[model samples]
Target chain A: MRDSRGMRAFFQVGGIVFALALTTVVLVASKAPPFAAYLNIALGAFGSWEVFSNVLVSWVPLLLATSGLLLTFTVGLWNIGIEGQITFGAIFATWAMRSLQGGGTDPAFVIMLSILAGALGGILWAMLAGALKTFGGVNEIFGGLGLNFVATAVNLWLIFGPWKRPGIASMSGTVPFDKALWLPTLTAQSRLSPSSIAIAVAGIVLVYVLISGTHFGLRLKAVGRNPRAAYLLGIPTWQYMMTSFAICGAFAGLAGAIQVTAVYHRLIPSISSGYGYLGMMVAMLVNYRAALAAPVALFFAALNVGSIQLPIVLKLDSSLAGVLQGTLVLFVLLAQGAREFFARKGGKR
Target chain B: MRKINRFILVLFLAAVSTVAFGQSSNFTFGLLMVGPYNDHGWSQANYDATQYVVAKTPGTQMIYLDKVNPADRPGTTASQLAESLVAKGAKLVIFSSDDMSDEAVKFAQAHPDIFVIMSSGDQVWKDGKNAKNIPNMVNIMGRMEYGKMIAGVAAAITTQTGQIAYLGPLANDETRRLASSVYLGAKYAWTKYLNRDISKLKFKVTWIGYWFNIPGVTSDPTQVADDFFNSGYDVVVSGIDTTEAVTEAVKYAAQGKRVWAIPYDYVDAIKEGNAVSLGVPYFNWGPAYVSAIKSAMTGKWTSHFEWNGPDWKNINNPDTSAVGFNRGSVLSKPAAAGVDKFIAELSKGLNLWKGPIVLQDGTTYLKDGVAATDQQIWYLPQLLQGIEGQSVSK
Candidate 1:
């Protein structure tokens, strides 16, 4: 049984490699040399220690968002509004910073409080969706998506209305916070802050342990498989679902807080970035496996950091990175389907 | 879920189709945009000019990256994109739009070997906010103030109810100056030519606070245009990047509302507005870009700030003009003739900068009879006094 399972995993990996190789061939024949472009991507992403450090900066948010998504996915919940949760997190964090702007409080203490505020913001948004799903009989997807719009409106309103700069209003975003209020960067050059990356790693570890080792994880899985059966077994399915959303939202919010404090050093309209959406993609690509989310999130982040070379060297759109990632997921799913079909056919024979 | 899957498929194909084959060349140039390449307004105009420059000048290869703004790319940055472009062998790079000022400054400082040109950038302007004349970077902008003035005149002449609207984009000095120029032209013609009171002209501005529309982040220009027409404003002069004003006006006209719009940036924008388009005040960046590319090719590239004006003889000439006002087919004969008359006066140096100019805060900007200098025009602090709208969000 072990040998058979190993063979299946190897085939699955081989199929993905084959699909990617085919895409590279197609790219080279029609337009750019995929080999040279791929080389550029590697050199840009990981050529030097400094460049790799920048990759980790992007990876932090991707990892955090994916961690939250992995939890919801485990419970068979599609929390599409993680994007809104992220925005609320950043907005809440910004509120804390702006509120404490002139205070003589310790910088480190303020940062901690701000991050906590961000978490509270994320939890509040997530709870709304959870309540809607549980009490109002609404789908999490619709609730989350609607909340995303509201969050975006709130962000824009803050920037263009109440939180607008003193002398001028611009799409350039609100005035950057003071340098002293900034999240401590790992170095003067890269945007990476060591604390944010540490939080992301801790999030990954927590997710791995929670999903694989605990009885709570087993119960969540049972509820996902059949809520009626889990209910018959005395499991409070609704509570599990709500807990999953709350936990997921907190992680996403932490990522958003880091975004405001570290990335731009100010709340811009795009403070949420696309990390929430990208994290959803990462979760789906990994088939909602928390254990697989870490490496995959890093890979996605690296692809984005590296594909800047597409437009530079080949006159190609940098969105090629997204295309490759999507193709990988599609091919992996197809291969998995094929394997299941063959196994059933062989068993019947 | 199915819709999202389809959207991803379409995005993938779109990305594939945008791939331009790299060609061997003696000179290569990079153009960056903060929005889509075919946005039909600001970025499209630059994209067309870049193609024109590359095709007209042989031995030159061109690579351009659109949607380079941080808002567009979540994981990367504009400066990083610029670095990759330079690494790709772009001898000269043009960072278009005002938002890229910080990115351009940082990139230019780091890469002294590469020449940088910032379009509509205030960084190199002598009196502009955050002004800095970096050795390798040049700032180039069209004399769009005159074009906007002509657009304003057209609106003022065309309005039946004396209610003209200015659909503005953001509150930067560039956008502020552009929007205010419309008010100036409308007031100038309404009082001097139409024998009407300036205040009665109802020249109001509604700022959308961005070059192009980003859903939820900026007020939708289409909605703003609809609101203007619904509230008695019959002529809308676009100061934003997109052709939403023209499109919205065309829709209102079909529904029996007699509304007109004048688009900004592209001369051909009138095509979308059809019967509702009065005209468009456009920037012809070809003349400027071609010269910059030529200078770089000849090893004579040096940073110089150029604020170019329209060719007086033929402002709409496809070849050598910095700015042009293209009159739409819907313009009446009298209005068209009046537009011509206005242009004629401008050709003989009709300076709108003459004093008696008051600021929005009721501060006197230019004393009577004193013409405004380039420095004064380049760094307008607020909307001119008579314009209706908030200069700052507060």
Candidate 2:
């Protein structure tokens, strides 16, 4: 067991080294100074208090999305519809804020209510996917993918149709809400909201504790490992799966709500900003271990924020960050597979 | 030892102050383009204008990041990106798209010391409806109405089939007025120049919902252009920021069809369509951008809105004109003469926006002989009558 554990660590380190080397080759091929590109990304992310705060602002939603995905992954379910769920949450939050903005309601109360509405919106959408999987005999992956497209369509329709700015229908998005409707931030100019950071940290902690230290978590693992066996043991398989979907959806909804109130302050067409998909990547990179999810999500967020410097400084496309991220995840997964293959071969010999 | 240390400290202070003084004279302006810098349309015009400014001003340098829209640069707002530019020693930043109005306002308000140039925005215009009191921000837009009018005359005279279609960007006040200006010019040429019946000319506009194509989010301009040609509309005027209309027209022309396109925004857009092109109404942003950057450099910057029009003496002059129309290669001699005559008439104060104008809903927009004010034209509430397209975004 000790030797195998050592081997796992060795392969994981090897995977990271390989990812860096591959990224270096790409930088060299693009004729960019590889060391400078890496340094720029590092400086862009943590060079100052302001840019670092921006990283935290990005980290909030990403961590929330990863925390949510951890629950669905724990249940052996691939909730690709989290993207749609996030979009629905943003829509619902925007709807609530728009309805309450001029209604003489307390601003704080309205923001809270809107966030709650977002959560409910996410639950409803996720339930539809859950229902499709549990009762309609459709696979979750396909159902989730279909729902994501539907969510995007609905978002575009609202932005271009009923919710469009008066006398304007452009992809710039709906009219921004008043300053009173914006979430309280750490500074007048910064997008970082302490409340949002606290909520995201709390969310990951709740997920970690739930997955590790509770009866529901143990039963969830049983359901994930073998639903038929779990059902025979009276674990109530479908219920656990649905419950996991709902919880994940709630977290995704909060992420969307934060995006509206704390970040954009309007219903932009790409409001979710691909955080739902990025979170899935973060979960996979961490192998769905809840404890390591926050740090990894932060690293991903830093990569995103830092890459903006590539275009500004090096004249390189910022999508190089995506390449690095894809390679890192691919190599880690490949390393794990290889380790298992070698172990099985040795045992057979 | 103490005296030697004091001398070293004084030397260090002198070196730092000299560096700071040297940096103050060297002006760096950052630009955020809504599309690729070399897109051959709106973004390219602004990019080239910045390059022009660098050439005209001795100490000026430009730093730019294109594709600044939300879809392309996910997780970063235009304001946040501007801050990054500021960190890289930019004292002034130009947000060069109307799509970035909100973020531009946010950035200007956040960094009052940083000069901001918001092209194609009216937020700083004191008389504008959406005006804000942003002291450090200036709004600049060219009077492309005149250019579009000239494009209309060229199309009016060149079309073998009297049907003209407009490939509109999105439903907005700016787009509506521009599309309406095309109609007004076309009507003037069709009746007054060609001596044709008004009812015989067909003018239609189809909005693709953005300044340029974004795959699933907008109607494909290539498909829309084909639809226009397939349905027998012989002249298609493109208002989007890309060359799709001309590219598609080239395709249809290759098939032995008599199709022509009028592309908008950049000066060389006619070159893109070559023989099938029927002139382009382009913004010459160099003079305006040079003046704006110089003002910012010399500390003469003050918030204002400029709606500069063409330099009629030489409309195609790169140094003086704010807006100009370049006739395409395939324009017949007679059609080119008609376009020149139309410009002469415009220079002589002939206003087509005058009077008896009606909305698409049959409501009167202007009474008889009543001319439109800048405000009236800028805030056009709906598509004008005789244009078959959505008046408002329902």
Best candidate per TM-score, number? Answer: 2
| Worst-scoring 10-residue span by lDDT in model 2 chain B | B14-23
Candidate 2 structure quality by residue, lDDT tens digits, A1-349: 2238889889888888899899999999999766667777888899899999999999998998899899899889999999999999999999999999989999999999999988887888899999999999899999999998899899989998899987788688889999998999987877889999999999999999999999998888989889999999999999999999999999999998989998889988888788988999899999999999999999999999998888777788888899899899989999888888888887877
RMSD (CA, Å), each prediction: 6.3, 4.6
**Taking candidate 1, what TM-score does its chain B reach relative to the real chain B?**
0.92
Best by lDDT: 2
* Cα error, candidate 2, residue B153 (Å): 1.6
Model 1, range A229-277, lDDT digits (tens) per residue?
A: 9999999999999999999889988988988887776777788888998
Q: Write down the C-alpha DockQ for each prediction.
A: 0.33, 0.44
For candidate 1, give the lDDT of residue A52. Answer: 80
Alpha-carbon DockQ of candidate 1 = 0.33
Please list all clashing residue pairs in model 2, or write none if there are none: none
The residue-level lDDT of candidate 2 at B216 comes to 72
